[model samples]
Target: MKIKNSLVILLVMAFGVFLFQVYKQHQTQGSLNKTAAYYNTNTPDEVGASNVVTAIVVTYRGLDTLGEVTVLFLTAMIVGYILRHGGKEKPMKNNTSEILITAANVLIPGSIILGVYVFINGHLTPGGGFQGGAIIGTAITLMILADPLGSVKKAVLHITESLSGFTYILIGLAGLLFAGGFLDNRILPLGNLGNLLSAGAIPLIYSLIGLKVGTELSSIIASINETGNKTA
Candidate 1:
């Protein structure tokens, strides 16, 4: 009975959302649906970011970025808490084979470097905090596979997680207080188009995001390993 009721509620809400979207689309005039109508292609070139999507994700819709950060934070916290003492991982010093270790050593640094480039060039490219951060986390994963016993510390991870969260929130508050609105872009020099230092707060945010994801994933893996889920 509960399942049937829940399904009915979900179906009703889904149809309601579909109707709302259709109404919204119908409300917009045909010619007004052009890219220029919704977003500024001019902003990307002016901001020195090659990627318009990056500009949109990190700058124009930074509030959404904040939400994404919050979600990642929450996920890391929830998973960390759950797996911390849950008896789920196996921490063998030799959990990974020698070949995997060698490969990870070779690949990890390169991946981290690429992640940095992505964050630095986010405004002018397709990558940003979310994408770059995920890559950074991947590097940490490689480090773990290479040396399962190499000392993954929660203290360090906590610092990274906290600092990144603080940095993101501080920047947002600065934007709100100084830029006239929350997550405003005017806090830093907007920079020239296609330049490395362009995009102002966007790159800064991305860097922090990279750090956060890297540390969070590292900690999660460590927790899982420590807990007892040693399938790897």
Candidate 2:
């Protein structure tokens, strides 16, 4: 019986490896289509948001962005729950000086602006919603690390994250219900590509993603630091 079980496990593992190989091949095939001229670059105007990738994320393949945000949210929730459960966090060191905090305060908004720029230009250039959102998340982490005492409110963070998630899904559903596909650009006016308002719902979705990433990352950082000072 034991040998039979071992053999079954080996077969399962081999099958899993085979599936992984197939997945890799499919991914390569998909990449080959990226440079194709039919790859949605025929926008009416230039993508308005700074990032070209953002356009691709929210406009062309928005479903993937939705899934990515869901993953981030689930990760944050799981990490917070795990860390909160008898898992004491070590107190964060107060190594950041006042000068550094002040500089962070000045730069946080700037970083956010730059992230928005990336999302806006996603179609015309390179960056997009996912990249810009990640940038914003990193910036928010810097703020939290620099000013642990002056952290953002948890209630606000929850609301921000929830709203962003809701807005993104609702927009997608609207497209599915009325428009063509899952992320069809119906509600948002598809302005000329390369222009500021181009790509319709793409900017809205990317901004939501950015907001959620920023708040979610900040919350994760706070979670670690929140209970670390427990009388140790």
Candidate 3:
């Protein structure tokens, strides 16, 4: 026991030292001023987005964002596959109180509306596709809690996922064909900055992303809920 305690203490000391070294290194390196300045100055004109963060995410680093979405898609697919058999089993009855159910029903629509609003205004404001999708997913969670055994429209979710993903890829290909590079946000007219329809393909791409992510997360929620029902 003494030896175990000593080893634990040694490990903690080593971890603390490592963290201190990392902190010191980070302090010495400072911020990348040149890169920051360039993005700040050039992003507005080049991407035609009022929000530089949106420009970076939906335009400059679009491929990276796509890759992230792809990874999430794959994970969701795997999880759904693993839980497929659960759909055949009888569901455990929902036992939520009337007040809880009523609250969930009341809040779900508002959450979805807010989610859509966030993704729609992504290029003009602080929020974006991922944030909006998460909000929608939360609404789904509320619905599931209210009615655990209820079926989500699997066909609609699948279609939304497939269509959105296909459209995003097609838009990227179009960018490669017509614009500066792959996933370029300039395939269509940029229009006036801060407009709902402006920022070229940004709003469209992000809208697709929001829908895809929301549906994907909902599917995951469905799978988990079904699996829980089966076990119960």
Ten-residue region with minimum lDDT total, candidate 2 = 43-52
Question: Per-prediction TM-score, please?
Answer: 0.77, 0.71, 0.91
Comparison by lDDT, 2 against 3, better one: 3
The digit string of per-residue lDDT tens for model 3 on 1-232 reads 9999999999999999999988888755565589778889998788999999989988999999999999989989999998887645763556889998999979999999999999999999889999999999999889888888775777888899999999999999999999999899999999998898999999999999999999999999988887887753
Each model's C-alpha lDDT? Answer: 0.75, 0.72, 0.90
Better of 1 and 3 by TM-score: 3
lDDT of 2 by residue, 12-80 (tens): 999999999988887434343655444445534433444444555676777777888889899889878
Best by TM-score: 3
Over the stretch 1-232, how does candidate 1's per-residue lDDT look in tens digits? Answer: 9999999999999999999998888754566346655565466544445677776676777788778777877887888788656643454446578789789888999999998887776676677766777788788777866766656678988897899889888998998888767776678887776777766777787788778877777777777655554443
Model 1 TM-score is 0.77
Q: Whole-model lDDT for model 2 versus the true structure?
A: 0.72
Candidate number of the best lDDT: 3
* TM-score of structure candidate 3: 0.91
